[model samples]
Target: MNETRERIALLSKALDLMTDRPIRVMEVCGTHTVSIFRQGLRSLFPPSLELVSGPGCPVCVTDQGEIDAAVSLAGIKGVTVATYGDMLRVPGSGSSLVNERALGRDVRVITSADQALEIARNEKTRLVVFVAVGFETTAPSTASVILDAHREGRGNFTVLNLHKAVPPVLEALASDKNIALDALLLPGHVSVILGLSPYRFLPEDHGIACAVAGFGAEDIMLALVEVVRQIREGRPRVASLYSQAVREEGNCLARDLIDRVFEPCDSSWRGLGNLPLSGYGLREEYSSIDALKRLEISINDTSPPSGCSCGEVLKGKMLPRECALFGRLCNPSHPVGPCMVSSEGSCAAHFRFSRGGDHPWKH
Candidate 1:
């Protein structure tokens, strides 16, 4: 604990001494946002260094239209919808998967893609549809399971592929002039898969400094220190602070699995609209197990909730407190938006740690 304080003090001093102009850095991973709040790192930052949460939470960034489609899929006869637990309570156009389950629709929360396949193998009478959602880290696992189902000839198994790529969205964020970003704290897990190559464009094209960081407090701080240095010296580039896990090339076998099973398609994000080649669709060869193809459910656009500012929050345009519905109408229990419902959501983290209490890291 004493060591932690010394490290924090050193990094804090480094930031205070180096930072002159106001620097806006976005932590572009939901896990990073949660870790920052949980470790009380918010109180330790210098006033010139501002950290904002990006659309890093996979569940939070899922467009409302996709949620609605999942709900629609759940309502089908002889269909069982399986997805990660985080996706259960997210509100769609009219209802969520949990609500559909309450109404006797077969909506099951699963921890792994294999569980969905298991359900398909066991429940021969019912068609099990896995709601595949996540970035590259989880995509390879989903692809692996899709192959398992196909190899085992589990014809009742299909996937509502909502998997998204991080780089395309990062490119979109970098190009958006409305949200000024001096630097970005890139996602650790996603970087472990994508490596450093995909992020070169951010610095090369947009002139933004970025660093990949793990979920630990010190890991995040060290990454910030790198960001501060880049800003101070005006040499913006991509740096990986969490070199223990992330590699320059990333995992090749996983990438090969993703390529074999899925292909890039236009995907819609909640805050950011349809980004070209931002999402993964099961390849044409895998159409036999594609949920949308089998179920014939189209992902039509839907308007977000009237007062929820989740989109703005995701884009770093607004903080959680800036939204009127944040605490009033959108607490975790009664989430009016996906940002509040998701565990990695910026609003949820703020509500849990930043509400009415004394600052956690003051000591």
Candidate 2:
């Protein structure tokens, strides 16, 4: 639309104003990744401005261990594992949730968290475990579902809380010396719950510029403008361009709901190693609903297969093509890592939008 074009123009002007040095701005949202590529965002920027994808995609960042845990739950008799459609194909220990779903396992893909609650209510005999994966955006809904189930006395409903917090991963990335990021475009949806306040550490502590960005061409463009302006001014502070949704405190009610029902635990991510307090777990009172507890499943807790550079890609040290399996073996049809399976995946976005073309940053 006209709005998209105007935003693109604004983004170009912002990049033009960045006459100091190469500005490495990363979009920290999966939806932003798809939008950036689908709208040809890189094409709009000059060689001086480089936009990198970050560990923003919840499905992509959902650790292999978590998937393995989910798969193990599917292995249990009379236990149904429900998840989003995007998570079905994500590989987990040489197998996938999709393949397991096809093998007549009780794995159902639901659109919303409430649907999982419904399944639990209807199938009282079957233990329904919703594989909850996402950041603040989806966490609220998952928390709401857990609250609803408890209020309605649906004892069969349990959530395998693989929900991840963004700040830890961001901190991990910032501390790693391999990456040379100048600024980050934070995920708009996540800012809705955790808010831009949590991002204070990145700018204040780390001296990295971060702009909270909204999804869509216009929104992304505006975020770029903010990032560029901040860098140009030499002021590394967190700015919220998605003010329509994100706030400094975020949705406190939703956050309280999650805090009440779940507790933070050291969880692993696909590319990122074990981070402190990155994962959430259901409260002990809800242990009966905890599928892993009820089913008595243990995660394999193994490392990635040899020669997979998913860790490098997740750390923002390597691009998708840098991985051996990227295009040759890991296509959309056959994904080796979570980064290639999901639409917002870095590999998927690049292959879908930038492959076979000379990237502006390359020249």
Top-lDDT structure, candidate number: 1
**Whole-model lDDT per candidate:** 0.92, 0.81
Query: For residues 1-363, what per-residue lDDT tens digits would candidate 1 score against the true structure?
Result: 888878888988887888888999998888999999988888888898899999999999999999999999999999999999999999998999999999999999899998999999899999999999999999999999999988988889999999999999998889989888999999999999999999999989998999998888789889999988997888999998888899999998899999999999999999788999999988998999988889999999888999989999999999999999988788998999988988899999999878656654556
Predicted structure 1: clash tally: 0
Candidate with the greatest TM-score versus the true structure: 1
User: Which stretches in model 1 have alpha-carbon errors above 4 Å?
Assistant: none
Each model's TM-score, in the order given? 0.98, 0.93
Off by over 4 Å in 2: 1-7, 356-363
Q: Which ten contiguous residues of candidate 1 have the minimum total lDDT?
A: 354-363
**TM-score (C-alpha) between model 2 and the true structure:** 0.93
lDDT of 2 by residue, 277-352 (tens): 9877778877777767767776657777566776777667788888877788888887887788888888888878
Model 2, residue 33: distance off in Å is 0.5
lDDT of 1 at 19: 85
